[model samples]
Target: MAGYGDDAGFQQWASENGYDVPSGTVAAARQRGSSYIDAVYGERFPGEPAGGIEQDRSWPRVNATDKWGNAIAVDAVPARVIHASYHAALQELQSLGSLEPVVVAAERVKREKVGPLETEYMDGVEGQDALAASTPLLAAVEGLLEPLLTPVGGFPAMMVV
Candidate 1:
């Protein structure tokens, strides 16, 4: 699938941030970055993909609004999303496969006891998949996208009727 940001945008971002990537690999890195963005934040976005279920990438949403309640145009992908994609692409380029989700083994011991010691393990904090638990998105990207994201565990612009 095509990435949200183009090679030019990626190049500009790279140059401004002091990162140098091989010219030939920029496209693939951007694609990987877009994949990472979808995998990490797809469910938390404010609205359905503007292109519908078959949409390749997650931005350009329909029925979505900004943090200030301004409508996001159906044909426009937010600049923050594009910028965040650049951040993700740069990271992926620096370390191939760095954005790939990793499924970490969950804690298995709920409780344990030794001859003279007693210990209790709390339940694994509810919700969140092990994959997301292991792979964290870049903090800089997160900051850019936060205003466009729905609050976790809360409905975004839910309808009452």
Candidate 2:
């Protein structure tokens, strides 16, 4: 499937926002941008893929509702998603792999001390996804998407056995 928004939409957004149009094939940039979106935020989205597990993209989710508990049309991709995608696409276009998460050996430094210096690190479970330790979601993009995402570390509104 194509990215969340069309090339024309992206161009329009970039112009209106005063962002320089990145140099690249728009289709390729959009694809990478869309893939980045899925990789970074897919699991945090409130519902399952509308087209099921094999869906090419993560929008149009089933059972996704707004923050107010209003039902979001299953057939629709919200504008926030589109705008976030566009913002991400612009980042990807500017620098390939800019939005990709980096993987590193999980550091386990619980505490360390040196002469006149000491540091203690928070403990975390091992084998966490690399994304957790890598570059965080850009603030602008996260601001646009935060309301639509399920709250991390919080329970779902309903659970079915």
Q: Rate the local accuracy (lDDT) of all candidates.
A: 0.78, 0.75
Model 2 off-target regions past 4 Å? 22-24, 104-127, 152-161
Off by over 4 Å in 1: 104-125, 154-161
Q: Return the clash pairs for model 2, or none.
A: none
Lowest lDDT 10-mer window, candidate 2? Answer: 152-161
lDDT of 2 by residue, 1-161 (tens): 79998998888889999987855577777887788777777888887899998899998899998777878899988888888888888887767787775555555466899998999874433444334545446667777877888875532221111
TM-score of each: 0.80, 0.76
Model 1 vs truth, CA RMSD: 6.5
lDDT of 1 by residue, 1-161 (tens): 89987999889888988888789999988888888888778888888899899999998889989889999999898889888888888888777877774544564566788998989864433464445444655878877988988876633221111
